[model samples]
Target chain A: MKLRVRHVSRYVFDAPVKRLAQSHRLWPAETQGQSVIQWSVETENAVTGSGFRDGAGDWTQTVTVKGPVSEFTVTAEGLVETSDTSGVLRGHRERVPASAYLTGTRITGLTAELRMAAEAALEGMDAASPLDRAHALARYVSDHVVFAPNRTEPATTAAEALEGGEGVCQDHTHVLIALAHAADIPARYVTGYMLSTEDSQGAEASHAWAELHVHGLGWVGFDAANRCCPNEYYIRLGSGYDASDAAPIRGIVDGATQETLDVSVAVTDSARQSQSQRQQ
Target chain B: MAQADQNFFNEMLNGTDVRAAYENLDRWQANMPSDLRSLKQHEAEQLFRRVGITFAVYGEGGDPERLIPFDMFPRVFTADEWRKLERGIKQRAAALNAFLADVYDGREIIRAGKIPEHIVTRNEAFEKAMVGIRPPMNIWSHIVGIDLVRTGRDQFYVLEDNCRTPSGVSYMLQNREIMMRMFPQLFVENRIAPVDGYASALWRTLASVAPKKCEGEPNIVILTPGQFNSAYYEHSFLADLMGVELVEGQDLFVEGDFCWMKTTEGPQKVDVIYRRIDDAFLDPLCFRPDSMLGIPGLMNVYRSGGVTICSAPGAGVADDKAIYTFVPEMVRFYLGEAPILENVPTYQCAKTDDCKYVLENLEELVVKEVHGSGGYGMLVGPKADKAMIELFRDKIRARPQNYIAQPTLALSTVPTFVEEGIAPRHVDLRPYCLVGEKIELVPGGLTRVALNEGSLVVNSSQGGGVKDTWVLAE
Candidate 1:
């Protein structure tokens, strides 16, 4: 499937931001599952700085703007060809070992409740394969937490999400990753774009999931919020220990008394390519 | 109270006979009048105060900024002695750089089973952000300060390695300056090797590691945390001496894939940053979100080769006390050479047998935190009382992985002027090694003397003082 994605994030401050700097992981991962066709990231009234592929197999770029004026906007547009690989992430160059992912983060640290839930999910299935256990844990997370937008804050931990019993994809990914680690499997949180079939207009596109490193299969993606593994419709951008680390955009504004943020992302199938092929 | 051990090696005296290194100084002292000596001492203190050479002591009730007492007696070293120290310091620096590059890139040492995987992976000093980001010239620690302690005439052991930002080079320079000013005749009589070239050498070392994108002459600046930092004087002093702009985080920004310092005229591209801030506080967007002392996208610029950060982020892992044990192996593995300097025999409390031994010998060992610095969070076993030893035992039992124990060596002493006149005081040396295209160091280093009688701790914050180190010309 060929998908085109456009993501825009704007920040407005009540007072002028003396200085602003931002880091973006907006480019799609170059792996067997996805191939980048073309990608461009730009900012208004800001200068886009150096870009590099980081150790985590993510393309990161820096942006900075000096302003006595208020608003700053970052726009990322890209086209990527993706294929279904049974949710298996392959051929991604990362220097960190699988054991490094087992290190729990502040947001995904396993609580007693998370540990119990993970144990319960794998009960009577001790003889199953690691992949099977990972899938079972994903299912357990999906069933335990209802998908409800605005139910939790960005800093909400897996323990907090489990107690609340409802959260968005971020919370769901954190909970699943916590459980995966509790089961002694290395896991990480992934942030990317998902082409939602229900939203034909391709709005509400930003998504997050969890990836468990199964011994034989390598890293396998699992989306507990959708109760399935990511397919051709998903574009993987980056992975980290938790939501904060995996955030597509991390930034800081200096000398601003107050600031407001707005984000919009759209992912849709490219009709122009299909039309061109039909004409040919 | 404990007393100085008579068996310890004294740098100035051997069985009440002055060593050959101190012969000239001893003769000069005998000829000098007592009133003139006191006058010179007062002049030295006045000069230090006038130059604004002071260190900030946090959490202290008295004045925060206090001058590190300067001793007039110079610690002299023969050319042969200095040659060995120079070679060892260079070898250790090279090995440390090689270790950092390997750990971040391939982990060949870990794979070879020379060092444990968990020790590197689980270490808090091991930054995940620096996993595959190689710095300019593949050198992580551009400047290193290796702490050396002497127990005997030929026995020098590395106590710790400061791969991160090492302070006291400024003190080394200032001590020499004050000595030359107070006693110009002594400098002419004794062919002391010149140390005035360190600032230029440091500037060249930083310039040699500029990013590939830097064109022509690389623009260099010193990034300081601010005046409140304990090492602020060194920061400003180095910057002035190197003839570069001294900037705080607020004075710099990232734009157009490059880091720019906001000059009085406008923004100027910065190619190299001699950063004195810690890694966690170097980039807010990458490492710590709440850090106001760091530029937001500085790490991204660094990873992209836009600006070179001297002593690159994550270099701290190589100096971690737990990892220090593997440096010898690194020397053999990376350089195919034996370590020129010996590491003090260390007992890692994390290991079962080592923990058992450390706990059993708590009264005879000096236990230190793996991550602690500046003589903080340490227990000198011999001086510690029973309750203090017991307290450390409980702390060690709770987190065995965080502690390391070493037998207290009888540190060598130098003759220092005290209230009761010249007496022996324990001392240690910290030589600054600059690594870039090549490893270079001045012959002499900062020799810190414990002011208190019989005290072995030489940290300035713990009532220690500085002395001029003289490497005699051949």
Candidate 2:
């Protein structure tokens, strides 16, 4: 499936700044299952700087804006062709070993409540394979934490979301990661885009999920929010220990300007392009 | 007077007679008048104060900026002794650098079953960000300060390795300056090697490791956490000596994949940063978001080969106490040689047998937290009271993996001037080894002496004093 993704983030500052710098991890990962057709990231009032691929196989580019301007906007648009390999994220170039993901981030640390939930989810299922266990853990997290938007903060841990009994895709991914880790499965948080289909729930361009490293199959993505594995409709951007690390955009402004941010993203299937190319 | 341990080596004395290394100093001290000696002591204190040589001791009641008491008597090492120590320090530093490169890249040490996988994988100090990121020249620890303690005449054991931004080189330099000013004739009689060239050596080492992108003369700067830090004086002093800019996080910015230091003139490209800030506080975007002491995209710039960060991030994993036990194996594995220096016998509480033994011998072994430094969170078994011992026992039982136990060896002593006269006090040496194009070290090191009578702890933060160490020229 060929997917087109557009992400725009606008920041309005109360006061103008002398300098603005941002480091973006917005480029789609180059993987065996996914290929980038064309990708470009642009920003108003900013000039693109140098780019490099990080140890985690994510292309990062620096942008600088020297201005007294009160508003700044970053736009990322890309087209990627993805293939389904049964959710196995193969041929992804990441320097970090699978065992490194066994460690948890502050946002995914296991609390007593999370530990109890993980233990309860795996009770009487010890004999199951690692892959099956990962699926069951994802299902358990989805069931326990109702999908409710804006119910938790960005810094919310898996235990906090589970205790509150409500969170969004990010929280669900965190809870699943905590549970998966408790079951001795190496898991990491993944940020990407999901193309909405007729049979599927309306998918957001910005999506998060958990990927567990299975003993025999490598990393397999499981989206607890959609209750399915990542398929051809999914376009992976980057991965980290948690959502904060995998965030697509991170920056710092020089001046102390009270700012408000708005983000808009759209992930669409390029049906028109496919039909036009076929006719030609 | 407390009896001195017969087993411990006294640097100034051999049984009852003065050692050859201290013979000249001993004669000078005997000839000097007591009034002049006290006057010189007062002059030394005044000089230290005038020069603003003080360390900030946090969590204490009184003035935070207190001078580290300087002993009038200097510690002496013969040329032969210095030669042996130099070789050992170089070997240890090389092995440590190799270990860091291996752990971050191929992890052959772990694969070869030399070290446990969990030890590296589970360690918090092991940074995932550094995995497969080859630093310039593959040198992870550009500056290594190896702590050594002597027990017998020829016995020296490495206590720890300070690979991450080791402080106290300033103290070493300052002590020598004061010693020369107070006693000019003592130096004239003894052929003491000069250590004034260390700053230049350090500058060259940093310049040699500049990223491949640097052209012409690489611009180097010292990245400091600012004035409030305990080692701020050293940072500024070194920068001044090296004729480099002393910059803080706010004084630098990342642009065009390179780091630039904000100057009065304009933005200056920084090719190498001798960062004194910890790894967690070096890049806010990459590590700790709440850290205000780090540049926003410095790590990204470093990853792009836009700049070189000396003593690269994740170097601390090599110096962790739990990993310190494997240095001997690392020496053999990397250098294909035996460790010239010995490692103190350690009991890792993570092991079942070691934990059991540590718990059983709580009063006889010194238990230290694996990640703890500056003599904090350590229980000296012989010195700890019953209540402290019991508390530590519970802590060990709760988290056995966080603690390591070692037998308290009799630390060597140097003759120090107390209120009465010269007396033996425990001392340890920390020689700074520079690693870049090559590994080199100054002849002597910072000799920290426990000021309190019979006290074994010698951390400057814990009220330790420093003595000028003299490495006699052959």
Candidate 3:
């Protein structure tokens, strides 16, 4: 599967910060099943400072901002080629089992309501094969947690939304993890960028989803919020046991007494480029 | 000071061998600050940077490579101080281990009124999930780092205990390596006991706790919370030193009641894991459902004894700041022995009398948030301005259970380097101990120094550096 992804995030500050510095952990190194043919990242209002390999062996890029500017924008575009292992799980799948993956994760202490709800949701899921069960689980979470903007400070969790039935991508991912673990399946969180439709402006947006290890098929990506498997429109940044690990960028800033930020992202797949590239 | 010495420092540029680099220490001593303590500290700083003893400080919006300030000069401890520290640390670790065992199986400590059930229940770290889980070795605080501070020449006090992610051993090893090079004559003459065996000992400890099924050749991995963590470097360093694979939660899974690590080869079975991640972030399925840093089914495998997680999940219950004061009692309760080390007199704000005393002496005590670490939410009343003290008073009044207060002590000082020369700086020691099948203390501990002239805060995040502590040959 070939994926041409453009991710653009714009942070407009309430007040311009003087001397801002940051390290971004966004770029994903090409692995065996995935290849990046072309990729580039550009930032406005920030100068690239240092680049180094971090302790966990991830490549990180540092940026320093000499800013009195009201806004900063980071744009990343890449052409990624991913293998379709719908038939057989290979590559990263070998390390994680695809079958009966949910069995070992215990969800005993979770809210009684959530446990019962998950149990009810997985009534027919166990009978289904691992791949189908994963799909069902994703679908159930998507249905259970409504995708709505949650302006909660920092972020909210799956259980918090279970009572309300609404949350953003993070909630969807968490609920999916809880449900999968309830069934004894191993699930992980993925932070990345998802392509936006034509109506949306800009390049790409930060997105969160869940991945389940399916027996025989390997690790399969599922966007519970979208109620579908990750397609060519998805560009994976990193995978963590949860959402916090795979956060696109995390670091500290100095010389600022306080900081308030507003972020916007957009992901668009252009038909013109697709047709032109197909011709080439 | 020697590194800055014109002739000898230049001479050292000519050679790369460890011995040649330190030969100039005698010549540089004359130009150094009059304070021998400061001179040693300056040398320690240069050595730490050179040898790469670093912690990744993730500034909210800055580059994270700012290494923890390292002091070249060590805080020397006589045999007497060491014996007391060893006894205190061992007692504390053993008691905590026993406490955890009791909490999971017996709950005898709470039931006996030695520690109130309400306090245990109120502690945020106390986990209901861990209620019935007894580990293979009945050990929870497997890798303990007991923080100790010297108030006077011979008066050492227990500052705190870090049973969870107590980092900086890597700094100790690397700092000593650099110090030996910078002062080979002093090091050779003094005959410092090598701390290089810590990794091997840690590995042996982890190996000892491997699940019985995979005893022959257990696959051991060091689990980290990933790169962005402040202690990520330590995790990788320990992994490298122990000759084990460094894994993140996503790199592992649970299946068939077994824990498996994702390896280049395949889904290899993992029998033992020295996880640096906190209990809440170790297994999302077991603790916080929102945590992405933990494997979903890891706790299940642990429950079945399919794998061993050292300093097992939920160990934080014993190390809670509020529980620190009871360590002596815990020692007496579990080991039937008097405490070898004494704790700094701590006042739990949760108590009415202590709260009143703390409120009255808000200007003289050091107040700390029960759950905060690395000096994030600590206030020294005397050092703090009125506004800060008032802020602390308001906070404590609002939530007394979440705070603790202790009288500020003149934390002992060792000479360290400054911009002009050497000066006295407050320092503390945290020695790492490993208990798997047996107890082994790393000869040298991480000696943290407050860089600020008169500051008592010695956390790396608070601008503290570390020194290579040496246990001199007896």
Candidate 4:
């Protein structure tokens, strides 16, 4: 499946910033599951520098706009061809040891609720394999946390999300990651783009999922909010221990008192869109 | 007034005979009158205060403004002894660098089953972002400060290793400077290896590890956390000695491809950074977002070979206490040689059997936190009361993996100037080994003397004082 994605973020500083710098992990991953056709990430009045692939196999670049700038727009548009690999992240280059992902971040830290959920998910299936257990945990999170938007904040912990019982893809991913860790499995958060199928509610501009490191399969993706493992329709970007580390864009501005953010994401199935255009 | 404890090895004497290395020092002390010795001690203190060398070492922060006492007596070592120590220290330093390079890359030591995987991979000091970065010269720790305590005439044990921004090299230099100023005749009478070459050697070592793309005389700077830091004096002192810029986080900014230092002339591109800040505060974009004390995109520049960071991020993993136990193993695995320096027998409280042994013999062992540094969160069993020991026991039990216990070895003593008279006080050695294109160390080190009588901990925060270390010419 070929996917077209356009992600643009606008930032308006209330006061003029002395300097602006941002680190972007917006490039699609080069793996067996995906191939990049064309991609360009650009921001007006910014110089992109120090671009390199990180230890987690994410291509990151630094964007610097030195000035008393009040506003700017960062736009990333890409066409990527992906394959259905049964959610298995194969042939992905990463140097970070699997054990390192077992480390929990502030938002993905294991809480008692996550532990109990993991235990309950695998209660009768004591002999279930690690892959099966991961699936069961993902299912448990999907069934428990109903897909609800604007119900939780970005800084909400997995424990809080579990208690709320209503959150979007980010909360579902955090809770699943926490549960995976409670079961002594290594897992990380992945940030990417998802095509909004008609039936899939709340498929927004961007999507997040949890990736569990299984013994034989390496990393396997599970999107609990969508209640299925990610397939060709998912465009993998990068992964980190939690949302902040895996964020597509992280910025630091010098002496900007207040800033406003505007984000837009449009992901479409290229073949279907082309067919509709032909019909038109 | 001084009791010559026969149980502890006295460096100045060997069974009632003056040691060969200290014979001249003993005669020098004999020739000086008591009042003059006292006056000279006062002068040394005044010199130290005038020089503004009052800050503490590492994270052992007491009163940052208080001056650490300068002992009039010096610790002496013979050429043969220092030669062996140099070899051992260099070997350990090489292995530690090799371990770090491997831990971030192939991890052959872990694959060979020499060290456990979790101990290295799951360590809090291990930076996942640094896993694949190939640093200049493949050296993570440019300056490896190995804490050593001498037990016997030929026996030395490494207490711990400091890989990141090891402090007190300034103390070593200042002590010698003052000692020479006070007693020029002593320098004339006894031939001591000059330690002034340390600044030059350090400069060369740092310059040698500049990024490959850096052309000509690579510009370098010392990145300090600012004036409020406990080790700020050392940062400025090194920068002055090296004739480089002493900069704070704000003084440097990342531009296109390179990090630049703001100067009166213009923006000077930095090729190497001897950063005295912690890794968590080195780059705000890559690390803690709340940290305002770091360059926003310095790590990215480092990753792309625009600049170099001395004692690279994640270098602390090699010096961790739990990882310290495997130094000898690393020596064997990486260098393919026998370890010249022996490690103290340590017991991990995380191991049930070791924990039981440690619990059963609380009074004879020293318990230290695995992650704690600078004399913090440690229990000197012999020095602790019952209540203190009980407190440590519960701490260990609550988090066994967080603690490690070792036998309290009898640290050797040197004749130190005391209120009553010269007395034997426990001392330790921290020799800074430089690694770059080559591995090297100055003959002398910073000798920390426990000023409190009978105390074994040599941290400055805990009644520890400074002494000039001398290596005699053959």
lDDT (CA) per prediction: 0.87, 0.86, 0.67, 0.90
Write down the TM-score of every candidate: 0.90, 0.93, 0.56, 0.94
Could you give candidate 2's per-residue lDDT for residues B1-474 as a string of tens digits? 345458678887877877899888778877878898899999999999998878742213245478878998999899999999899999999999999999888889888999997788777888888887889999999999999999988889998998888888988899999999988888889999999989999998999999999999999999998887777888999999999999999999887768888888999999999999999998878888778999888888888788999889999999987788899999999999988999998898999999999999999998888889877999999888999999999999999999998999899999888777778999999989999998989888899999998888886667688999999999
| CA lDDT, candidate 4, residue A110 | 76
Residue B410's lDDT within candidate 1 is 87
DockQ of 3: 0.02
- At residue B186, give the lDDT of candidate 2: 86
Per-residue C-alpha lDDT of model 3 across residues B1-474, encoded as one tens digit per residue: 322222111211223332332333334544455676565666666655565545642222233566676666565554555776777777778888888888656678877889865455446666544555667778787788888877654567887787766776777778777776666777656656778898899888888877766758778899988887767777888889989999987787655546667678888988988888778887654456567787755665676567888877768878876787788989989899998778998888999999999999999898998878877999988789989999998999999999988888777665565665555677778888887888888677888788996677776667777666766566
Minimum summed lDDT over a 10-residue window in model 2 chain A is located at A271-280
Give lDDT tens digits, candidate 3, residues A78-133: 77776544312234312121221232223212566767777887786556787877
Clashing pairs in 1: A49-B256, A49-B257, A50-B257
lDDT of 1 by residue, B329-424 (tens): 889999999899999999989999999999999989999998898679999999999999999999999999999899998889988887656888
DockQ of each: 0.69, 0.58, 0.02, 0.75
How closely does chain A match the true chain A in each prediction, as TM-score?
0.93, 0.92, 0.72, 0.95
Among all candidates shown, the one with the greatest TM-score: 4
* Candidate 4 TM-score, C-alpha based: 0.94
- Candidate 3 residues lying further than 4 Å off, grouped into runs, are A1-280, B1-53, B57-63, B348-363, B367-405
- Residue pairs in candidate 4 whose N, alpha carbon or C atoms collide under 3 angstroms: none
Superposed Cα deviation of residue B233, candidate 4 (Å)? 0.5
